[model samples]
Target: MPFTAGRGDASEEQTDVESFEALEPVSEVSEIFIKMDFRSFRGNVA
Candidate 1:
């Protein structure tokens, strides 16, 4: 699977993983980052 961070941003973080075992940690960490970003954005908007 392939993933990218930050829409329309040139300096974005990205990753690709070929195996399920290798992808597990990446997926977990990605979920955590997404949640954190969402919370921070919500705080900014509120």
Candidate 2:
């Protein structure tokens, strides 16, 4: 999705605002990144 400062598509802006409003707070710290092991990473070696 394009994050325009302003004067973008009106529908997209409205949808983004509505989606943000619908979110609720969570108690736990969210995992923003995935944890991986070195061997496991090697398994997907291309």
TM-score of each prediction: 0.22, 0.17
Query: What is the lDDT, from 0 to 100, of the residue 12 in candidate 1?
Result: 26
Error of 1 at 42 (Å): 19
Best candidate, TM-score: 1
Cα-based lDDT for every prediction: 0.48, 0.46
How much is 20 displaced in model 2, in angstroms? Answer: 4.6
lDDT of 1 by residue, 2-41 (tens): 8765556333235333433433443464465564555455
For candidate 1, the lDDT comes to: 0.48
Off by over 4 Å in 1: 1-27, 38-46
Question: Residue 23's C-alpha lDDT in candidate 1?
Answer: 39
User: What is the C-alpha local distance difference test score of candidate 2?
Assistant: 0.46
Counted clashes in each candidate structure:
0, 0
